[model samples]
Target: MPEPIADFYAVIPAGGIGSRLWPLSRADAPKFLHDLTGSGQTLLRDTWDRLEPLSGPDRIAVVTGRAHRAAVERELPGIPDKNVFLESEPRDSTAAIGLAAAILVRREPDVIIGSFAADHVIRPAHLFDWGVRQAIAVAREGYICTLGIQPTEPSIGFGYIKKSSELIVEGAPEAALVERFVEKPDLDTAREYFADRSYLWNAGMFISRADVLLAAIEENRPELHAGLIELAEAWDDRERRGPVVDRVWPTLEKIAIDYSVAEPAAAAGRLAVIPGHFDWDDVGDFASLTKLNSHGRGNDLAILGENARILADTSSGIVVSQTQRVISVIGVKDIVIVDTDDALLVTTSENAQRVKGVVDALKLTGRGDVL
Candidate 1:
């Protein structure tokens, strides 16, 4: 295990219903609450485990929706009640992470805060730790740093980061100046980027000094910064916290941290990126879930769940069963069957990305009870 960074504090943004991984992931119980990887641990627990070595259990905090506070607390008993920052509603990543930074800065001014997502999967723990160490080195120098993953394939699922030049930081030798962040592209554009070695997958992992992050937010989104500051002021106050959050939480602008801070910082040459040498996956959809299955690599079928009784003869793909159902596949290929107690989703891996549309249609049809 790598030595813990004394000033480093880790924050996890654990919102999002993960609509793409529907049936298996729901509104009341999001994907982070379940063990999607078949690793016998929920993604939230895995995330806490990953950060514990670096931040220690006490230095880590979690930001989640108000509805999920009890579940998240149940999953992570090591996290203190004070560290579990609950949002009244989903205000996107900017407000969620920014509030944590603002509140943490009040507690410890010189804190180096790293905001990591709660549901992403990263392999070869040592490499991730090293990447974070390097990011911390760069972050201490006052630049907003993000860990960028090397593109293993021309995957359009993730955003790309363009690195301009090498940063001559002492500890972070491979760190580079970020030119800009690009959205998920088409196949041709993704291929072009893959051919060029300057681009990396933006994993949405950011590490920075708490004050520096707040300043960047202040520069780009003054209104949001002001509201967050106001909320942070009353955050620890027992008397004023409740009334203030109820009044100000929903009024804050619902924007991603990428748009609110990262892009602007990149434009101003204040963004740095350290290339990560570890394998990463956001597990966005069932297709991604197929890839994360360790036993499904070369096999015709991959099965998730202890009680899942899937008998596939020649079918190739993934099958997830949350109940005691005997699911059998004959000759279908790339099929995805997610069988839960309340919902059953049957689709192909080709249409896995379109599963979110099903959730949208369900909501439009007033079938949110199943969602």
Candidate 2:
């Protein structure tokens, strides 16, 4: 049985459109709204399911764009209507999360709030819960705590967190004082970091007391903090929320929480990381998605949507076919074929990270229909 955390409030920032997932993930219908895992539920739905059990439905809130409000509501039916925070525009993670922290502070004053991205796919629920519990315990000690993923490979996709030694925080034996945050390193550097025991993948899972988080933002990103505070003060007032947010939200700087708070806070020794050994994937590209599809069960070909529609003959790689179309690949290795009704993408599984370039090309050609 899942018991609610005493003063814990969950904040899920479900804003990204996941341009790399292209035809499957669109602007109106973002990646978070889709079932990328084929787990019978959308990513946002899965995220809500994961957090609701910890914080209880009422204590969990979603911060998303106004454009996605209807979709978010439709997806998470149990979410309180008041808990849906609608942003005027895309202001990135800092603004979205700062807005949530401010609002939670307005109500509970010193509540514990954890911000998790909706698009990530984490497995072995119990392991994730344990790590989050540790993070929460560290957050209660007034540190901006993050759940750092133990790297299984020398993956360059994620930022790395360097740790010197463990903290003496009670109830969090695994928590470590973050030395510094290193950006996504090149292949050589990534390999070096992977070999280093102290380096952990920065999972971007932020847990902190509402007041502590806002104070960090005030010290690091004063401009964003000001706008967020104003928006938060108006948040409880239904009639004033739209007006004040419209006036102030666009003026806030567009920066990630990593830059606005995490790095700076870590420099001041205000950040701690609880190492998470659970299987975690941000699902940033098709290559990772293919790996997820091929997990546990061993098969020659990786099929995401319809296994019946995909036929492979001496072929290996990923195929995402969803148009009731028969896709047959013969003698091709490491090929990635994604078939949608309107747009089809063909690339090697190795070049999956470059899919964002294709999206940019479409934008340059003014192809909004498929974007």
Candidate 3:
């Protein structure tokens, strides 16, 4: 139909503590700041670059903790200083997104907003732009649009979106009405979902008008919405925005957007899933790193390894230092070898999934230096 609105805004939520990619991805330096792919660009920078064309620098906003504001600013220099909204303490995605909605709704009342993670990789900018336009079109019609990726395999690490009958959005050929939102399932359940043909991996990318999202928040989670409204009102007061965000953020209950809002909206038939036909990867943990890097051969060096023979059977392998340090491996397979300047990790690929456990142990044992 008509050309999509040129005044669309984007909000990136980057407040997570990234414990899974420990040692490298620390509390001070989240995964979004790390160059996980060994590409010069960090994940946050990559995402910003991808969204630049659609919303430009001034129109984009990043919601993160005060600890990460400098890093986020460093990653996205093109963004205006006022656009970087900072929370005093760490809050979950729901709070971060709600705060963003509150702030953006004030500036551009009818603006369509797109909320995405700072650490996902979706290739081919053209395809991503197209998908965003379609999502925006659906959102303009008062429907909360979420991008659901076609699962490449049975992945239990990610949540799934069950799609109902196809519905027509303005620009998209076919958009599926979201039937239900499923949490991370067991291996057997994941396989069953894969067999259904209607389930897609929830990409965590959402689009909707500011008012629509606020309405969804009000309907699904009244408490959260009330908190958001209070925060928004306080934010309007110049002296209060800074002090209030710092004071009240940590007190907000930690909940994901899916659990707090998306699931409820889907159940009420207010959510729709748009098929995103593009390469998508959350790069959530080191296991996900190997899966994304499966195309590389011998030249693949993770952290500090040289000429290392790494055969990742199940998307879990070594994360070595790339400082030209030589690390040799022979007859070793299905292992995660992480070499840092201070710490070394050698565990089975299966055990690699428990890196968060190591992070917790480090925290419990008061070894914050390594963490």
Best by lDDT: 1
- Among the numbered candidates, top TM-score falls to 1
lDDT against the true structure, per candidate, is 0.93, 0.88, 0.79
When sorted by TM-score, best at the front, the candidate numbers are 1, 2, 3
All candidates: TM-score: 0.98, 0.97, 0.91
lDDT-superior candidate, 1 or 2: 1
lDDT of 3 by residue, 1-371 (tens): 32335769999998776777666677887888877766678889999888888887678889888878878887887888878888887668888888889878887789888998998888877788888888888888889999998888888899999999887876877587899999999999999988888999999999988888888878777877888878887876788887777666667777888888799888888898888888998877776776565465433434323433343332324555534445566555554566666777777646656889999999899999877
Provide the clashing-pair count of each candidate structure.
Answer: 0, 0, 5
Model 3 bad stretches (over 4 Å): 1-5, 296-316, 322-325
Ranking by lDDT: 1, 2, 3
Clashing pairs in 1: none
lDDT of 2 by residue, 1-371 (tens): 55989899999999988988876788888889877777989888888888877899898899999889888899988889878889888989999999999998998897999999999998878888888888999998889999998899998898999986789988898999999999999999999999998999988999999999999999988877888888888989989887898899889999999998999989999999999988899989887887887765334568777443977898777888778888889988778888888999999878988889999999999998887
List the pairs of residues colliding in candidate 3.
303-320, 303-321, 303-322, 304-320, 304-321
Lowest summed-lDDT stretch of 10 residues in model 2? 294-303
**Cα shift from native, residue 144, model 1 (Å):** 0.2
Query: Candidate 2 — which pairs collide?
Result: none
